[model samples]
Target: MTTTLECRGVTAGYLKERPCVRDVDLTLAAGEITCLLGPNGAGKTTLLETLAGLLPHTGGAIEVEGAPVRSGRPRDAVRAGMVLVPDDRALFRQLSTKQNLLLAVPERSRRSSALKQVLQYFPALEKRLSVDAGRLSGGEQQMLAIGRAILQRPSVLLIDELSMGLAPVIVTEILEVLRRLATAEGTSVLLVEQHVHLALGSADRAAVLVHGRIADRDSAAALRADPGRVERAYLGTDAA
Candidate 1:
């Protein structure tokens, strides 16, 4: 498998004195989904932000497709074929869906093609193009967020929380789309999610984080099948 994203001894947080994620090591392969699972305050979001260059890493390094990408250079990461879709699902409330999609891709000529490609992943957005993004339901907004990132066609897509605040059915649909993206487009997805079962069910592999450290790492199916292990790791009773 082609390694798309790599982290070695990564430590980062809001304050230098208090790193939330410590000595974390992770590898994401192209055409695979790797779900980062943990409870609240497990430093999942901090790690995601650090990888995206939103927060400076206090130590260690990050590499995308073998090239070094330092902390605090988010655009460089984007230019290097990486995109971060935060949990907030940031979108222009007043802008139409079509406009938002168009804006995501810089090339004016390719905007149409990008829109079409993203709409294929999210066909529900086809008829809602003219509607204001803010007016869309929670699920539609999440779809739009993912679609916009898809338009970037990043080699590595970092999503903070894909299933947050969405209905179960909608979450399932979105997870299916992510699986297709990994299988068909070879996109390396690193997602931070709290929904343990759903994320493990959809991902190729799973990494459990607890108290700023990786507690367990295994194939998603293995982790799902061994719920007791997952429980121990999540609860910090067994940081294997």
Candidate 2:
């Protein structure tokens, strides 16, 4: 099967001399949801950022649909059909929700299509279109951020910490949308999440990152079936 995204021995960090993530090899298949789980400082964000072309990779390569993606070139990544939705939401706080989402489609002719698609997934946004993004609830802001990303029609979506600072109900709602996108739209997703069980529950596969490397990779069902193993991987005891 062709992979939507592939990272081969990718190494990157904030400092050029000191790499945070090293020799990470990961892949996301089409229409699959891959959950990345790890504790704080595990370099999960570094890996995602590197994959998204926001950070330079000092070694190895990243490929989207069998083509090389230039490291540190975010626009090139977007052109390659990859999009990253960071934990910050990256919404224009002062702008109304409609204006914020409309920005996703630069061409005025495509703005309606973009808005329609986003609203299809997040109907709640239609009523709140006139409201400022900052004034919306946390979940609503997240929905808008994700809706904006989806408007880009990316082949691979890298979502960083979708569950951060949101209620479980809201998280569930977002996860459900992701599941549908993966299944119905054939959009591959790489999700970094703190809620291990919730992520593992919705994901097709899960990878545990420890000390900037993948400690274990397995089917989500298998991981859920043997959570003690996942715990060991999370605690960095698997290698001991």
Candidate 2 C-alpha lDDT tens digits along 1-240: 558999899989999888999899999999999999999999999998988889999999999999999989999999999999998989999999999998888899989888988888999899999999999999999999999999888999999999989999999999999998888888999999999899999999999998999999999999988879888998888632
Best by TM-score: 1
lDDT of 1 by residue, 1-240 (tens): 999999999999998999999999999999999999989999999988888888899899999999999688888888888899999988999999998888888888898789889988999999999999999999999999989999888999999988888999999999999999999999999988888888988999999999999999999999999889999998889645
TM-score of 2: 0.97
The model with the greatest lDDT is 2
Distance from true location, Cα of 167 in model 2, Å: 0.7
* lDDT value, residue 212 of candidate 1: 99
Total clashing pairs for each candidate? 0, 0
* Structural RMSD, model 2: 1.2
